[model samples]
Target: MPTPIKMPALSPTMEEGTLARWLIKEGDTVSSGDIMAEIETDKATMEFEAVDEGTVLKIEVPDGTEGVKVGTVIALLGAEGEDAGTVDAAPAAAAAPESSESAQPAASEPPEPTPASAPTVAPAKAASSAGTRTIASPLARRIAEKKGVDLASVKGSGPNGRIVKADVEGAQSGSAVPRREAAGPATGQAAAAPAGPATLPDFGIPHEDEKLSNVRKVIARRLTESKQTVPHYYLTIDVRLDPLLKLRAELNAALEAQGVKLSVNDLLIKALAKALIQVPRCNVSFGGDVLRSFSRADISVAVAAPSGLITPIIVDAGSKSISTIATEMKELAGKAREGKLQPHEYQGGTASLSNLGMYGIKQFEAVINPPQGMIMAVGAGDKRPHVVDDALAIATVMSATGSFDHRAIDGADGAELMQAFKALVEAPLGLVA
Candidate 1:
């Protein structure tokens, strides 16, 4: 008997996926739990594992083909002694053509039925001037061809209307030349008008533009939507951290023999969780129809990867010890950089933290991740003077900015939440039970 391997749902929001590579080719033997292929979702490229042990009979979807819906049978597995190629399954689409130049030319490829669903484009024609036998600018010709209008029908209004770029485009595209309005209050000198458009920069370079991976495409679409549709506001506060720094050195010294090394980020995470408990309003999401609050606080911490950025959470962070949080953070960061994080490792957080202290950023704000009420951006700690007891004194300070959903929380509530966070960080001992 032959078993089918369907595409699995790799993440909660994943719909269709890209078959990035085939780890096991047809006729190869596979065991349960062995990796079979790499699938790229809208966020990251991940592996697909074999669920049943057998010989690979046939592969359906080929590498680089995307929009493969979940549960679509991607491969066939046959019995140990069975001939694999004859197993009946849905007719596999032809594998994507290999783009490498060393491979055989496309003309030598096997015949494939052209899918009726594929998009088609009509050919374009170059536009020429009416009476004169001169060629128009490329931009004008393209605009004219798309409009299906004759360039001869347009009247040039320049020195010769000279059939310049704008004249041709305006005539063919049916763009109206603005009627000169009555001169404004500044009309006395020469009726000076605003400068018209000049040739723009050639921002695009001639280079290979590889199609975006499924994860990157989705991330771009979602982040654009969040930025455009969601109303966001930011508030920043400077926290004095001299006391916290002293506590960190003392704690690390006391725990050195126990092999526990805690970082400033770990201490910040603990403080953030405790602050969320005190200001429960900040640990919430605003559904357009309802306000949702969480009993347990989950804080998402940002980690930079080679491909892009990813945020992994520390669940119930307030209840965990500094050492435990530090250890788990190290592991999570490692997995994130390697692009091997599980879906659970990156999803579902009530808030997010983006720290750039390692890069020496003095201050910055982050966009809020959707469904999360707040995102905190932390900057590097630096020495600065502050007035204390009516006298100026030097102190270590770190600036933190919180970007919140205006719909989910108000300015006063946001301020209160930040104040609480500042207190928790400034008084380091308050974080521990």
Candidate 2:
């Protein structure tokens, strides 16, 4: 009897996902912990590892198949000394073809999605890592086609020399044959818009539609729900940044040989966590009948990724030194961009910090990510007139806004947290102490 390979839940909240790619095919021998496929969960594109090792008997879901529910048997594995081709087709409903050859996905690939699975984002090279197919990431293929680059000639850079989006962007044209463009949808993707039928009438504008990745769709749905259901209020404060900047320079000089660098956001994350400790009332989540207060701050830092904005948490940020926070933040951010972030790397935070200072965004209020009581939005620090020791002088200042769930945190408590955050940033040394 062959064992069925069901789609595992990649996250605590994932119910279904797009089977982004199948790294292994039928007749391939796999072992425990082998990465068999990439699944696009609601949060990120994560690798699905094989737990039961055996020869790949079948692949029920072709690459790029969407909306596959969790626990769906995606493939089957044959025990040692078992023949893969003769495995029962009845298990996965012709998971293979009717012919003698089994688990051939190209035959099932259709024009509907315009090679919907065309991108092997982490592309397999001319001879794939699996030694069976040429793979390019879906995005890479789309861009390659649009840019007149041929996949056959471009070398891949991903694992096993897989071609990724970045690789495709810089590759020289591999063909002058003028490959025909695969037409389906436009390439426009929005983090805030749900990808589906156009909800409004078009004014005869020439545009092609692009399918929304799972991450974009989830962002659109969740943010909409948050705004509609959660009662929100905003509190803004002006904080001087000169002390923080000065301290950061001193710390970086001291820690340079250690290769550790601190950003304003890292210090701010620590300040927010400490402030949450000082005003515990603000560190809470709202339940309809109960308010859940937290003892520690797992601050979710908002990072802008290729897909959308994701908040990877700094767990127990209050207890970690600023250097540690900077190190962890760098690691988490890299994972977030690569779409390899695990569920625990991003889920369940008591609060969030969204910094746009680098982009020179003067000030903006961020919408609160639900269940989390509040989000601190930090803007750019510019020289501004300020009162110091009862006299007005120019100071490096930035505006910070806290968006709180009125249901979970009182306005006064939110104010106190803001005050504490401001004091910590202004004094600066308290952060290291």
Specify the highest-TM-score model's number: 2
Per-candidate clashes, comma-separated: 6, 12
**Residue runs of model 1 more than 4 Å from their true location after superposition:** 88-210
Instruction: Work out candidate 1's RMSD over C-alphas.
Output: 15.0
Give the per-residue lDDT digits (tens) of candidate 2, residues 174-284: 552242233223654322221233444568877777777889977877787789779889999999999999999999999999999999899999999999988999999
Q: What does the lDDT come to for candidate 2?
A: 0.79
In order, what lDDT does every prediction score?
A: 0.72, 0.79
Q: Model 1, 344-376: lDDT tens per residue?
A: 888888888899998999999898888889989
Each candidate structure's TM-score, on Cα atoms with residue i matched to residue i, is 0.72, 0.76
